[model samples]
Target: MTPAVAGASVQPDGALHAYARARLADGDGALGLAVASYRAALVQDPARVEIARRSYVQGLESGDRALALQSAALLDQVGMLPRDGTLLMIGEALTRKDWAGAETLVGRMVEEGNFAFIAPIVRSWIAIGEGRYAPPVIDSKDRFASLGLRYADEHIAFQALARRDLAAATPAIRRALAVRSSDGAALRLAFAGQLAAQGAKAEALMLLPVGSAGFASARVAIGKGKGLKAAGAAVTPAQGYARLLSRLAVDVGSDKAGGTLALRLARMATFADPAGAEPHILAARLLTLQGYAPGAITEAGKVPARSWYAPIAQAELIDALAAAGDEPAALMLARAQAAELGAEPERQVRLGRLLAEAKDFAGAAAAFRAAQAAYAPDQLPWTLLLFEGSALEQAKQWDEARAVLQRAAAMAPNEPLILNYLGYAQIERRENVEAALELLKKASALKPQDASITDSLGWAQFVTGNVEAAVPVLERAAAGAPTDITINEHLGDALWTAGRRYEARYAWAAASIYAEGDVAARLAAKSKEGLKPEYAAP
Candidate 1:
């Protein structure tokens, strides 16, 4: 008998041993080993629904579908399937063409008071499989109901195309598109396919949007006289099911329920259409959102080079690498893709960000400059300019940094972060004290709760000889960020200037705990001898 079939009768001590091993592996980030240990633990304690559920999630996150399925079976046996688990089982049933099983699972989902938001979409899939269409009830006040109505219309369009009812499909498609611009990619693709089926290849080509770039190969296949049926659109039940599932996955991923179920749904969509890069990209994004960076990288890396989504997937992989703290590898990969980076200003910006994170400030500044040069004047956003300026500042190109920052400030004068950074830089350099004070005040007003901005304001006041006025501001800043070395040090300075000698020494000692090198030495000297004449109150 397979491990899935084995009875749960092992001793408690044996189960505990396996569970401890699983916890150790998980803490070490040996996720594959952790999954194996979890499975072993579950086998030793088959009645432990918590262990089975955890094992199932680990299996899904690790891309071990077979293990996930086995765990799902165990969860079912123990009556512990959650909404997401029910969706997984339903997807599995749909993949196997077990329509009755999927319908039963859907009913179970509804009774559990879960997935009610997406029930209409699920029911539509069922209706499609049963060779019928369900008209969605539109409730403008209810967000999910609105989504259901839009999705129902799109599915109806697919049904119309399947039955060669182009006139009926066109209006339905139009209504679906009118619902939301973001949700129209699949609808647009399906409509284009239907047009191609009706011998309107030129019209279909014109109707294809940039979002349909992922389906370029399929479009080309259609143009070469392959019918919609041959190209895998709405011609067959399985193809239609895959397309619907892919769309549903996108919807679910963007919803408030979060990405766990969405990842599972996207995984199923990939199984339904392994040739499509869209589903893989969706799965990768959902995996990233779920904090499975390694899994995200793997899924994104699967997109073939010829597909339009390949570049997108590659970018996502780079982000996942950075998220996973493999910054050196991310930098190398970014450099390797330099040829592709030239045309993609956003990619260049991302490379700059990675370089910045790696502390290669000079390289980061150069990358930001390249991005700036590549972007059209109208395309340059304030954030990009701010990043370039920040990178230049870190690289110690002070003149260029100040100039770029001034330009960014001009563009986004009300941006608190920009105001704070620029103000702090000016104060640090002891240049234009009044101007810095004005900027800091503006920033403080915009974001009254920002400790850094508060600290800058107080530090400026202290440096400018307003010892009494600085005390309260610095105290607030210190209270908000008690462990922050700079804030603590500033608080110590202000306290000393206010004649609170004992408190100043105490604050300086606290600051010294987290300070380093020059700051640490300065705090130490201040703790022993008080503020020097230059820093002393007038």
Candidate 2:
């Protein structure tokens, strides 16, 4: 027995136990480490098919393609490969231009009843590559047909583009656009590029919807006679692979899976095109959304400095730093970006937001002022004015705050939040009582369920000698916002004025639980001595 210990004996039981423990301990946030630990465990017992399956998925999610491939090979040898593993293997074959191998894998996946909707697109692409035109047939009766139609049309257009058949591509693009009103951003961008390449510059520009700066920039590039050949085309194997990955990333990123799959796919895209900033930008955004700030920062840093996406990546990096509680670093980066951008109102607004978050109200106000100076008279966002007013209020510049808030209220007359804020500020200042009441009434009407607005309305009534009317409104506000200290405090004052001393004491006790600083002290005194006659309603 001792002599028979040839090489290293695989302890399947021990390895399986370790893998189970690691799986249990590895939470979603530490997925990268979990995948590595899984790989190490698998190495100890290579014949463990179940462990191999899990390792393959974890590797894909963590962007460890080699590990995924290795696990896939192991799973295939044991007849335990899942549909996803088969797809990955097929993708790898396609990447290497091994069309025969991809076809074989695709056949196996189809036989297993997996990804029935997607399998045909792979076949269609393969057929187009072989100089045969075989368009995918999507049955509308199929359960997945609605979801698959847009992807099918888009892929058909790509195949057409690969074959340099603009006539064929145009109709497919139109079919895709017809499937969903708001479904296409990347698709439209690619189609616009094709239009521009055909010398239809106005048509291309018209295709680009408003609010997409990326598409706008591409329109500018096309206008300069840069020709949309490169932008519109994905004929190369690498480009097709990257485009597929980006589409999958978008689909998966919208779910509760929290961007892990999206980030991995984007990472693969970067390997396909190192100079392309889109993949890196997508990865950075995914990481940020998943609360992996450090990872986001690293991905954002990978974008080329001269790339069109660099500024956007930099802004995301700054936001990531701020979200990660590195506010000082965020502020420093924002300031640098603002200086570099030079009178860009967007950057100025970003600087103001960062400063406001850091409690540097004066600095925030200054940044907002700079933004206001840069904007044309008619172009200022009401949000900009609101932020400026709030910052000035925080900085104790009351007159400036009032003036800014008034202008904001004028511009956004129907905005409930603006109305509520200005009205509450006026009430606190003990000036413009009638105007404040009117504003609060409008806000309450606009947002009937809003507890804060109701509280403000109730408090206004109390301050204006309508004690009985205040009591019911304050009661409703307190019911809606059971834990809001201000609402409870106002309810307590109203109850006291309505001659319900015991109920008032109970309300003050509730308010005390959430009170802090000066409010807490005031509540404590009120609870001890009840309200003084001076504080009671007339």
Candidate 3:
């Protein structure tokens, strides 16, 4: 499979061989190799739109900026530039100070009508670059009219503040923040940072609401009489363009199907303004969603410690580390975050969940208890009680677990999850069998389609010597959740009680497929020896 194409002397089949290699690498999740192979294929046959498109996407995913830009240029040459390509080309035009060229690209984007609401904002920036800045006309008839108006007011305020026109900036920024559809936290941080950058620290402090976690870094800086420098202010045309694209990346990412497109836009925004935090955050989230853990961590880590979104980025970075199979690092980071943000109950809860996932049940319970202590008495969350109780139970603290579970059950009396859990735990311990059966029945009624709750009810019946009743319910549970280990094992026990030895063995075999440790040994023993003779069926 050596190249045979003209000027491509490395492969026999040239582009075809390279394309096949790229697809194979991509299918194996080797994005770096995929991007390189795709680039080599495109080099052999520059007109291959499919190869160019794949190279462009993989380049962005793999954090290969050069390959992304090269493919974007190729897409533009073929007049088939995607949204991200159009944005990159406009950024290039802006860098070259080609206002007319940027506006021409905006015109093409408007004609396409996919995300045309942003065209006016892009044009406004281009005009500002051309020394002809003006307030954008809000089209009430536009599809994204509300969004357009919010950004329009935001830009007006930004320009006013840049010129030190306090009167105009005051009302414009207020109006923009009043809409609440756009990211108010980001807007506040940006506007406040702009004010600080302009030496109006007092005014910036006034704009940032008190006790806003997102503004923690900014508040500290402004309190120190230090001016906070933001990456984007809509003062420069390129910065304005990057700001809008980053916001667009966030907006587009709300749609589950638009992740890849959102990542492309986020990467393009980063390319335009490397220091902007929002685009990096958006890219991190998109990368996490796409299962690119290392890329997610890198993007999240890019947020400077002094950035307004630093806390959020730090949290996301910890999560990315856990997703990347570095739970020890994740736990270390989570513990540090909890210690630093002692008043934030959510951080403690996050730490608790991570500890539980790592099988440190006692540590998890302690973290959950800490979260509970951090919360005000009136604001105590029942969910935290549930988590703490579950952890304590796993740690073999039966009395404390029961007490905490009862408190959770009292707080959320009708919650099916709480009911199911409490019922299942009681049934397992052979405590208050009749009451546990009632709870399981209520939970089953609340969530009719829940196989787990149904399995609990069936198991309760079996342990109570209602073997005839248990057999049918366990069969139904097994059918509902065919591969669930617990459900299948319970079905085996119920079938064995009903004198169905062959069917019991079959059920045990199914459960054994995914069982491990002590459960695996127990299932294997049961499959060979059948039901114990401790008092068969009464």
Candidate 4:
């Protein structure tokens, strides 16, 4: 009912429509709705500098400083904002108490200055909360000290709160408020200890949420649920916080470290805010821990239920399951997420692999075929053939496996994994011992310290009637992998063939302990029967 509305009605549908809605929502004090609409508007007019700037401001008005900062970053990504704008956006986001928008921002700001000013101050408050000294960094480290502006005292107080230095934060707050009696900046300021992260269900709190809903009830139990519960009703931001952290970890290439951290955070985030992506992210992590393949593919099973990230998570989770020998589970998830995941090249490759892993060779081939037809530069088809061959071989369909593998080898001649697997399979089947030996030798050269490769080399040598040479190679192979029954057995056989019956008996005896299943049991029984001495020892 304002001029902006009148102008919007006649304006062609685009960014302004969304902005109008945001303005309406803002007037109503529907902070969450206003934030959403403004963002939607900004997305449509990404190139409009004023719109981009206003988008961030609107976010702040809704008490979602994180989202506001993120809008600034999006503009930065499009080269719309100046460096100072980026710095300012980051600064504003970090100084806030409510992190409802944290799922969108924070990291961009942290990188601007390594949080030299903010981190220490927050740490100071955290220390005070637990009865400790404000760190040297708080007293002298923050770069803000260099700025020496009127807000220096307040900056220190904020940093202390960020660090959970409640006592230090309290004094700084007093000094700051005294200096600036009516600053609107402190509208939603929550106490330091009251807003610290509380494990899975209770992530780092906003410490300031006078505007919208907080995840006070919905909580997760990342790894330390009891500790989280102990801090109940206090901290607990939006559910997306855990997923945001998880995504950031992948972005920064710190997966192993990130994975551990994500799992803990996700448990809390998912529990605290199940409506968000936290659950899906957590599910993805759980699947990874449960022996699924690594990366995006093995993360579906651990996803919190009903999350939008479910399809993405499923794609990753299925691949992991397939790689790890959980074929059935992989197939089920792949089928479920196929429509949503098929568009992604990596997901397509994973889908193909899952089909093959499940011995649905036809399905695997079709997936690969589709990926190939799509002309995907990543080349899912080549890997699909390898998987198809493996599935066929597993089913004792030798000819089919051989055909598919040969094509795969032709397509990917230099790939070590494919060459090694094919050569090893041929060796086991007694089809091409010489070729298999050559292939395995190449693999050994590529990986000299690999015990399995060394063992294969020794086996090949023994089969080729080079017993004298096989003995030392097998001995080294055994040394590299002392617990390998195959290596020990090969050494024993090589020794036996090389006229060292006594040594051969000792080697076989050693092998018996490491052996298992039918072959091991048979070998153990045979060794127990005592071999006839090749000619009675003198």
Q: What TM-score fits each model?
A: 0.79, 0.68, 0.81, 0.47
Q: Write the per-residue lDDT of candidate 3 for residues 1-538, one digit (tens) a residue.
A: 3233335344566886898789899888777688888878878887878778778887777767778888888888888777667777787688678998998888877777776887778877777787876767778987789778756777778778767787889889888788644456666777888887777778888877665454666788877755455422446777677777776777678898888788887887777777777678777877878777888999999998866778778878888898889999999989988887433677788899999999899999999999898668678888999999999999999899989999998988888888888888988898998999998899989997888988999999998889899888888989999998999899998898789999999998999999998788788888888877531221
For all candidates in order, the CA lDDT equals 0.73, 0.75, 0.80, 0.54
lDDT digits (tens) for residues 1-538 of candidate 2: 1222234354555665556654764565566677777888778777877678778877765567777888889988978776556666766777777878878877987788746667667777667656688877877898878655657777777777766677887788788777534435545666677667776677677777543443556666777967466665555444555666666677778886737667666766665555556667777777778776776777788876644355677777887888778998989988987776333666788899999988899999989988787668788888889989999999999999999999999999999889998998888787898899899999999998999999999998888778988899999999999999888888998898789999998999998897898888888888888897544321
Model 2 accuracy (lDDT, Cα): 0.75
Residues 246-353, candidate 4: write the lDDT tens digits: 233232223554453334333333433444443444445443653324433423555544332344455556656666667887777665554442253444556777
- Sort every candidate by lDDT, greatest first: 3, 2, 1, 4
The alpha-carbon deviation from the true structure for residue 319 of candidate 2, after best TM-score superposition, in angstroms, is: 1.4
Q: What is the lDDT of residue 202 in candidate 4?
A: 26
Among all candidates shown, the one with the greatest TM-score: 3
For residues 1-538, write the lDDT of model 1, one tens digit per residue: 2354256444556865676677778777667788888878777777776677777877766666776788889888877765567766776777677778878987887787656555656666667777776644455676567555646676667677767777887778778778647645444555776778777677667656422333555467667866565433563334444555666777777875857677777776675556666677777777777777887888888987755346567777888888787888888878766545234566678889898988888888888877777557877778877888899889888899999999889989999889888988888888888999899999999999999999999998887778898999999998999899888888888898788989998888888887888778788878888899644321
lDDT value, candidate 3, whole model: 0.80
Least accurate 10 contiguous residues by lDDT in model 4: 210-219
Clashes of each: 0, 0, 5, 44
TM-score of 4: 0.47
Worst 10 residues of 1 by lDDT: 209-218
